[model samples]
Target: MSSERKKPDIQYVNTDTKELVNLLIQGYESIANKRLYPADPLRLFILWVADIMVQQRVLIDYSAKQNIPRFAEGKYLDNLVEFLNNTIKRLPPQAATTRIRYTLSTKRETATVIPKGSRSTVDGKIFFETTKDLVIPIGETAGDIEAVCTVVGEIGNGFLPGQISKIVDFVPYLEKIENLTATAGGADTESDDSLYSRYREALSTYSTAGPEGAYRFYAKTANASIADVKTVSPTPGVAEIRVLMKDGRLPEEETIKAIEKLLSAEDIRPLTDKVVVKAADKVGYKIDISYYGFKHGQLSAEGIEKAAKFAVEKYKAWQSEKMGRDINPSKLNQMLMEEGIKRVEIRQPQFKEVSDTAVAIAESANLINGGVEDE
Candidate 1:
């Protein structure tokens, strides 16, 4: 039932991309009569070769020249980073946010209006600022407001929006500020290498039917971030959209409403269908793993535990309410052993069939070292 609607990781692709310097050096070495070395003549020849390549503009269909081969001004080396980032998804940085609750100060009877762009900081490392002005009328000064990141990055994530314990940013002029929900969507910009590895991902996206495809609309239009989505039709004309939020955390009310609005839009959702948006129902299961090789030094016990954790994480992402999707311990065992894990046995979670409406969630997996029995 979990359908993805986001950009998939780019696939690995090696193109016949060439560098001017490398090509020039190779050509010089190939010429037996030429002894190219660090000299004015050598420099000139290298510059000429680089200029020729630059003028030729011989690059992959998608490749762009970043630096021109010129010693003047500075060594303009190729900066593929910008080209790579723009070529595919913009690879946007996270938008920081916090839900604020403001109240009219009893001391001042007059309504206090704090203009938009009011700033707040957390330990000087990160800052959250009000997106719009906070207006507390003559009779009322207490209310909730939203503060978004002044900049983009992961530094602004993880705190609850409704955290009342601390008020990091506020002036004496404004009413007391209180947080209402934890900030969850603040994510670091994806790494260049990761984006580079997914070069093919930028070339083509899954059809709107792909798991990532279902999430694209909300991500694009609603500005909502979701972890997993299951698109299903329990019956005809009824589209059951269940989403698993990031890190198993529930989304903000505003986020959920925005998703509903977008999914129910005539252009995005099926015109003939009735859409119901709900959080994915998680089914937790504990896996007891027993294997003989960990103690014998096949891999460190901690390493095996790490492998188990990674496997569980992957499984969680893949689980859904799709028809005929069920937990198979043997498959899990096989996946683990592929990383040098041998003699595996899954003692818990006897396999069973799950219907299309039920999502299988692996809450935890217990690793038993050297086949130790758990009481």
Candidate 2:
């Protein structure tokens, strides 16, 4: 996009409390022919008006930028985000989910009700609730009962393996049933930048032979969290497709099947080509950093650590899994330096590059202050 097409930064300065108070006092003094001190009673009303006006301007500016930032507040923002997601053929990310499977006891002969909105607990976090009613017949068990139950809150719902051992609320005869292993989906709705980026990709590419421009359209089908996609023909008329999921986990069988089905259709893939789909391999990274220097004028220990960690987080997000990507340690060190840290050494990722068939992801980061060692 050209500079003219981009949203320019709005720079209107909203009046602060002091400015509002001074302006009002000046007008009052001009009309009454007397100066009033800051202790005047009417000043409170001025301050109140000032605060409300400032808040109004803030909301106005935020709403105006919805076309750019894509972050919304309250109900309007929620609907906008949802609309964008639906346009992209994926459901909005749900909170943490756990296995809330149901099974009829061997002796129980009748159908049992696993009522809707039933609640489960994973200690140290919020409770998870079922979305719908589940009917378990005789011989029905865990995964067969239903998809996993999700937590009421999104923050603690991810990566909870076998955590829902206790039941907080359920319909009668719950003790006779079994709750199988629940897994966490661990995803957030695609960000505004990600959505915008994908749109640009779609506009730019077409699925032509060798160039493989149109694979993005197929990769983004329902339930597919495409991190990266690569197509290769190991043999004539056979396109070997490897899909890397966004969260670095293997794509579900249904998602894989969907890709195969979509690719097989004559409208998308060539009629003569045989397409095979598979998930990419995940390679985990743990980065340990040793850096020297204070965060821009920050002298305190905690503040320094927080500022430095923030810079590392920005790097991590930009570097997270994309296919055919390599770990650039020099870029990471430079990024930290830009945040006012120097003399850096990246300890993890001893390898120079991650293969095209593999997706590189980091599990954890270890940032050490290194304490002003010789630079």
Candidate 3:
């Protein structure tokens, strides 16, 4: 269930709120680009929700007097909910997933199972617990039983409405500050007086204080990161490195040609899954989390070597491809994005054509045009 209600038109929102939303959208675009995924929809969904949960959790922990652990062992789902509520304090479920059917049957009279803190155990009755305590009728169908068990107990009690709302509100503020900072820069070189210096100072103050003062302070200097230089990281056994510039700022022809030259000669295996990119507003640094799946490994040197080897081969190939010895970045980028990653960060890369630069160059063309847009 999404809490994404259609908000009123921009005219209805005050200037500040509207500004914040734009900034947030940009941040989302930046983050979505660096993350890579395995070709698993369910896993992708999980990662998406997890990222949101982690983002909110970290924000709350950073702001609060007493920090909370973002990850809870043995109760990932439960802890996720709790963290959301306690940190964000929002009403309704922040995220939800539905399973239409289970591979394992619930109607069996007897089945072997593993019990918590012990090995296999046998029990006459199958019992389950929920947040709320409720009575289960005997001889009830599994579907009916599930309905009866809608006990709203403390499963994710820690996630409350108020906390979540606050966290949700905080993101826009961070974005607003960035936008404001960009507005401050002047055209003249002498006027270029350190956007970086002012940005750091504003960020430090924002960290200690709230978004109120910083929003006004940084608004004038806010500019986006432009694609200038692209960094490709390949550790052994990992996936190849490829990114695309969606914003029109980059010269598509030359960039594509450079990337294509690399991919042709490289030993890099084509990556089918997509990548996810995230940007930190204050630091202006991008963090990309790419996914590569390998067979389960044993706790042995051989297992470690296998993983390492895979990463090395893949990375070297990607590097070679990136170098124009194997494939072009544009083609590799297109293939990877098509496979599902569909998201990438242009990472304020240097445009040899325009010589213009910013923290990031994002494409809004997809936003109004519909269809999945590159983030």
Candidate 4:
């Protein structure tokens, strides 16, 4: 083995270093107080505690040594800076340097570059890359525009840092804030009742016609119209339309035409109603209509079971659309089980029960001699 001497590890003064460490901790606290703590309060607390612990360890190690290390001195500071730089260099590129990448297109390239330093020192001053583009394209949504403004503001403030930037890259931080608040507050799609109420109010406000009149006019003319009626797989052409009407008869030419006219004119689309008539010619004339209706004389005891299954599926879709929410699977299963039990009970024939002589005899025996003891 080679007899090469190893380098001596640097040591420090425990007491003085502790005091300096405390000062640094206080400084960090002050910085946090002024600049705002991290969004994750737990993470911020953990970081503070960890930093303090590390400092305490350093102080303890330094104080135990014969000669104390000078941390505040220029030479020590330079060494510390070099160590930090070395550590940073050793880290992954993703950990060390941050990059902001975006396609430079006519639609996207409108980034505002704020020059670093004042006008007096513009020549030699280093320019930092700050502020991403915010292009409010024509006919963008209010929320979209709001989100864009938020992203621009964040980028301008140099808040887009490394991995964090990846998350806040396309989407705005403010939008995330809004979403978090919305989620916490349980804000979702509007309810059917609310939609109905709003529509009713709107229809009622129309001049020369009440809500009822409007509804009738729409239902008869525009709302009722259907187009592109076709025979679905495993279903004949005639039965498809008949099942939708629930009248057990094929739709007439007049009926098809009426449905087409109503749908086209009123712009009413009934998602629930599967039966549809498509326009074949000009003036919105409907020809063939398709539906997922039950076949004639096909439903029996077995067929009823199949129909029940279909009903459950249909009910789920209906509830989801109307309530703007989905039913919990566990709750649905329990409900279905209870309903099945109730249905079975309902099917059972009721009969009057005669008094059992044997039970009466047993009760009488129990009453005698303070309830008979077993042998």
Best by lDDT: 2
What C-alpha lDDT does candidate 2 achieve relative to the native structure? 0.60
Q: What is the C-alpha RMSD of each candidate to the true structure, in Å?
A: 9.6, 7.3, 30.3, 33.4
> Where does candidate 1 stray beyond 4 Å?
1-91, 104-107, 121-124, 153-157, 173-175, 184-227, 233-238, 245-251, 266-274, 294-325, 352-359, 371-375
Tens digits of per-residue lDDT, candidate 4, 1-375, equal: 001112355655333444554565567668777433457564466556767777787667654532222222223433443453331111111101112332222332233222221111011221122133333333332221111111111121212222222222233221221111100001112222222222333343243222233323232222111111222222422111111111111223334544545533323423333334432211111111111222333444454444445444443332222111222333333333333311211111112221211000000000001111122
Model 1 per-residue lDDT tens digits across residues 1-375? 112213342322233224667667677768855656767588577877677656455442123322311110111121333444343442456675777776655746676776687666555656677788877777665766788876676566667644543345555655566667766455555443333334333333333322334433343333323544556777977876665544454455555555677777665565676777666654566678776454465567677667666765665555532323676777777776676565677787678776544556666667666642222
- Model 4 local distance difference test score: 0.28
Q: What is the TM-score of each candidate against the true structure?
A: 0.59, 0.59, 0.14, 0.16
Q: Report the C-alpha lDDT of model 3 over 224-269, residue by residue, as the tens digit.
A: 1111123232453232222322121222222233333433222322
lDDT of 2 by residue, 218-285 (tens): 55543324566777777998987888665455665545676788777776777678888888767777
Q: Which ten residues in a row have the lowest lDDT in candidate 3?
A: 177-186
Stretches of model 3 off by over 4 angstroms after superposition:
1-128, 134-307, 310-375
Candidate rank order under TM-score: 1, 2, 4, 3
| CA lDDT, candidate 4, residue 320 | 24
Error of 4 at 309 (Å): 3.3
Q: Rank the candidates by lDDT, best first.
A: 2, 1, 4, 3
